[model samples]
Target chain A: MRARLILWGIAALLLIALPPLATALGQPYYVDLARRILILAIAAISLNLILGYGGLVSFGHAAYLGIGAYAVGILGFYGIANGWIHLLVAIGASALVAAAIGAVSIRASGIYFIMITLAFTQMLYYLGISLDVYGGDDGMRLKSRSQFAGLVDLRDPVAFYYVALGVMLLFVFLTYRIVNSRFGMALRAAKSNEARSRAIGFPPYPYRLAAFIIAGAMCGVAGALYANHTGYITPGLMAWHQSGEMMFMVILGGMASTAGPVLGTFALLLVEEVLKGWTEHWQVILGPLLVLSVVFFRRGLAGIFFKPDA
Target chain B: MALLFEQLLNGLQYGVMLFLMAAGLTLVFGIMNLVNLAHGSLYMVGAYLAVTATQWTGNYLLGVALGLAGTLVVGMAVEVIALRTLYERDHLDQVLATFGLILFFNELIAIVWGRAPLYSSLPPWLQGHIKLFAGSTYPVYRAAVIVVGLLVAALLWYVVTRTRLGMLIRAGASNRTMVGALGVNIKLLYTVVFGCGAALAGLAGLMAGPIYAVQPGMGELILIQVFVVIVIGGIGSIRGALVGAIIVGVVDTLGRAFLKPLLGTMIPPTAAEAAGPALASMLIYLLMAVVLAVKPAGLFANR
Candidate 1:
């Protein structure tokens, strides 16, 4: 635990100093990339809640991200610039959808669960595409950065980067706390053996559903941040590939650990960045690498620092 | 009324296409217990190869044969190289690895075919329309697709029900250990089954090429729908796949054709216009959800 804390502390310090460091090095683009990575790390962390701990392989988690983003984009379209409102709507809407989807999906197990989640997300994606008022398939740009009533101008790159970093750290700590709590124990217990958990007076459905909703709501926040960071939102955000990539991040970071997904997000995106610089057809390389990693790199980058499921 | 009849035919054709994809998917899942997302990649491969071969040989039939053969070989190679080791692993690993394969296939296709959509023209004999009723006319090529799909389904039914291979497949699905113990070559059996599944997907892809834009990611557009069919049909059941695919196809096509005008009469045109297309697109997903709520195992779930 001490080592884990120190590791995160050093990581946090570096992130806090990233903007100034990037500026000094005359690589401002890195700050934007860092901010984007931090936002996605939040998403990866949320995925880990149900995936790593609760053992629910929701292949459509990106739907919540898209939902969260659409909440911000739609409200902004209607001239509601309140950042707090965007955050609230993002969370509330995501939770509601998750509840509905989870209520139906949690009844099924294994491949059925994965496919159901995926289909529902695709349903949402199609809905997003058909909403012409929201720019439909082509997507739309944010009119402006969300206003926070003078707390901090999201337009300022450094300010936004710090905000994203702060939020990411907060979620990492939050997930850590949640994973150690009674609810977390129940969630994990259900994951290892649902039948045993039920025999022990803890039915897995309610616990699993609750975790799914929490993860959805958390990812929604990440989505909201993503909209602001990119200043645009599209239905493509919820595509199955996004969900796949998020899963890869969770697996890459090391499942069931608090900071593992954060590490994962960094590794995946950084590698992709380097590969993009190398060639336009980077996916050809990344694809086989992902396959090989799943086959051989079972423990993930987090496995090097922490024991499995530690 | 004639329009409705024509739309129903469209739905049937679409469903028939879906069954081809779902049959292979369901068979693989039911027998091998492996979820192969790259099954759609095989579909794309078949379409690409057929299009390129058709262009090369100037004979559509020969090109199609070549495409089917190529997909079978690719499927067997994949089963031996990538999937053989995966049967023991968890579903999560299988999903990720196959997803990686999807990325590889899509990009490779793009590199070879370029990003633009490829179009294949039907032969002169298949180019005209067939008058089905007083006012409804369906394309001859589409009619041929329906006929072909039905023929394949019937053939599949016969093979699985009457043939020695079918008996072996059924036995393997129920008790692979016993089948292996009885001196069946399980590894070779898996490869053959996987190859047949790929060929089925390839057939669907080649059929779809003329009607749909053959593009890098075209396989995925239909793959999720195929997943819905499998889910609604009951995983591992060919009968379930057929029924589920038809239901989804009919429901989807009819919903798109009628939902707009139906809604327009009750609500404002603008609202109906916006809601109709969106709801139509989501119709099958909603259906799958309802089915799950009522029958979580699906309509024809044997297990």
Candidate 2:
């Protein structure tokens, strides 16, 4: 517990101090990297809610990202410039989509659930491409960063970074709370053994569905932030591969805990960037790296760091 | 009416192709209880190898035979090297490891094949169109695909029911530990089953190279469809795969062929035009969602 607390303290300090450290080092690019980490961490953190805690390995979690992003992009296309409106639309649209998908998909368990979630995600992805009005197979681009009406200017990179950081921290805290609450217990119990959990009279459906919604809503926020971060939206955001990458993050972070997602995101994305810089065909290296990670470190880096023996 | 028949044939051809892929997948799942996400990667490799082999050897059939062998070898190798360790692990672990393999294969293909969609052509005998009825024709290769798919399906059914190897495979699928305890070489049986499945997937890819773009990540595009077939069909049952594949193929093809006209009558032409293709692509997944909703274990799930 003390080690976990220390690890959390160190992570908090590193993230908070990253921008200044990067600025002092004259590598503002690192801040952008940090921004990516925080944004992706938010997505992974939300995924951890379903996958790590609820034992629901959704192979299409990135669909919520697509939904959240498209909500912003569609609104922006119509000239709805408010950031808050983007958040509201992003959250509401993603939740609605999640609810619909979860309502259908929750019927299937294990691999079926994975495939069903993936199918819905691909459907959304194809829908994104078929949207010839937006950009079709290419992708849609935003004209400007979301406007905030003098409250929180998202146009500034650092300001947006801070906002993303704030949102990520909020989600992390929220997940911590959810994972510890009675709902979290029920969700975990259902994950460990469904029939027994049901026999014990704690029906797992509502809890799983509720966790799915929260995770989807959280990822929706990340999606909205991602649109603002990249100043673009594309069908690629909702691709099943992207969902797999997020899954890698959650698993690498150590799925059962909140801090694992943060650690895993930082490691995986940073390793990705480093590899891309070193070689053009980085995935060749990253792929084996991922295999090795899973093979050797099943509990993940956070799992290792937090182990009492270590 | 003739066009509808052609569309139906197209759906049948597509469905058969899905069966070849899903047959192997379902077998692997049924027998090993492993979710090989990289099953698609093997398909992609088959296409790449076929293109390369065809270019190297002037004969297309020889190239295809070689390609299938190569793909089988690679699949067995993957099982031995990477997936062998994962059988004892949980499904999530299998998923992650195979997911890693997908990235590996895609990038490896890009490096080796230079990222271009390899051009492939059907043999002269397979290239011509076959006239079905008055003024209606379908590609001979597609017809061949349908025929081959049916033959393979029948062969699979025979092997699974008649052959001793098939008995072992069936036993393994039904009860792994029991089969292992019964003194059968479970590991060899697994390798053979996995190789056979890989060859089927390879055949699907090699055949597809002539029809679809033979490119990196091509496997992933069709893989989702195969997954849906398994879901709608039932994961472990080959009969379920056959039914699900045909249903998905027919539904998807018919939806694309007929949906626009039907929707145009109900909605505006522009709206129908815009929504048509998207809805067509979504048709199979929608079928899968509906099927899973109605029967979560699928239509023909073994257990």
Candidate 3:
């Protein structure tokens, strides 16, 4: 337990200190890329809460990202650029959608749940494409970054990067707490054996639902950060492919481990960046790489490195 | 009213195309207990092959036939090379692998054909419109699609219901181990089954090429709709694929066609104009959610 605490402490310190150091070293682009990785890591960690812990293979998690992004773009477009307000609205909108969608989706298990979530996300994609307002298929651009009350300057890339890093660390800490808590145990038990969990006098449905909502809210924050980072939002943000990519990040990193998402996001994004630079048809290489990883490595990179307690 | 009828027909045509793709997906899932995400990639290959074949043979029909045959071969090859190993793996693994295939195929296509959309036209004989009642006209090509889709549907129904192969397929879906114990060559059967699914997807792509732009990433666009069909109709049931396809196709088409006008009547025109398209686009998802709520297994779950 002491070892675990020290590991987490080191992780937290690195998360806080790495970006400023990169900025100090005159590698602002590297810091920006790290910020992007952290943002996606935040999203993937939320996904792990339900998928890794609760065993719900949701294919539509990217829809929450899209929802959160649209919230920022739409609210900002309407002249409400307060950073806190936009973040709150984004989280609320995503949570409400998750609650409504989860109520129905959690009814089915296995492949059915995956397909249903994918279908709902596709519906959202089409909605985004068809809406004439908010730039429709072309996507809308933010005139400016969200403004804070005399404190944070989001337009500054360094400040924004730090904020993203802070948010990611907070989410990582929260996920760690939730997974180790009593509620977390119930969720893990449900994943192991639903009938056994039920026999032990714990209902899995509400616990799973709560986890799904929490995950969605967390992803919403990532979505807002993504929008701010790019200063643009499009229907493609909610596409089924995006959802698939998010799932890949979780599995690629190491499902169920706290550091898994962080590692996975960095690896996946870096590979993508490198591949895109090498050739336009990088998917040819990357796609097979993904398949090989799944077929060969049942345990992800974190699994190979950290060796979680049995 | 005539215009409405035309739109309805258009929806049916689109649904029929979707049914072709969904039928193969449902069949493979029901029989093999495998979730094939690369199913869309197969659809894409069919379109590319059709375009290539047409250029080679100068006959659209022959090109389509070759496309179907080529896709079947590729399907079997993929099953033997990649998917055969994935049957016992978790769905998460299946998803990741198949997603990889999607990327590979998309890039491969881009490398070969360039990233621009191809203009695949119909034969001169199939290009004109057929006159319906009064003076209304519908595309002759669309009529051919409906006829071909119905015929394929009938053929699939016969294969799944009356034939020995159908019986084996049904048995396999229920219990693979039992079929293996009974001395059936389960590996060969899975390959053939996956091949048939690929052929069906290929057929859908070939037919869709004329109506929708045939491009590198076309498969990904239709893949989600096919998933919706299987979800609503119940996975692994061909009959369910048909019904679900029609329902989704019609609803999506009609919603896009008249949703704004329908809302305009009930609310402020400006508000209706603003919200109609968004609501219309999401109608099918709403339908899927409601169906799942009422019947968690599906509308016609095979098991």
Candidate 3 stretches with Cα past 4 Å from truth are: A5-17, A20-25
Give lDDT tens digits, candidate 1, residues B116-197. Answer: 9999987898899988868678899989999999999999999999999999999999989999999999999999999999
> How far is A258's C-alpha from truth in model 2 (Å)?
1.7
The most accurate candidate by lDDT is 1
What is the C-alpha DockQ of each candidate? Answer: 0.92, 0.82, 0.85
lDDT of 3 by residue, A169-218 (tens): 88988999999999999999998999999999998899998999999999
DockQ leader: 1
Superposition error at A240 for model 1 (Å): 0.8
Lowest summed lDDT across 10 adjacent residues in model 1 chain B is found at B130-139
Q: Report lDDT (CA) for all predictions.
A: 0.94, 0.90, 0.89
Ranking by TM-score: 1, 2, 3
Q: Write the per-residue lDDT of candidate 3 for residues B1-303, one digit (tens) a residue.
A: 999999999999999999999999999998888898888889999998998999899999899999999999999999998888999988878887999888898989999999999978788999899999989999999989999999999999999999999999999999999999999999999999999999999999988888888898899878888888888899888889999999999998999899999999999999998899889888888888888878877788867
- Model 1, position B140: C-alpha lDDT score: 96
- Which regions in candidate 2 have their CA more than 4 angstroms from the true location? A1-3, A307-310
**TM-score for predicted model 3 compared with the true structure:** 0.97
Each model's total of backbone clashes: 0, 0, 0
Error of 1 at A269 (Å): 0.6
TM, chain A, every candidate: 0.99, 0.96, 0.95
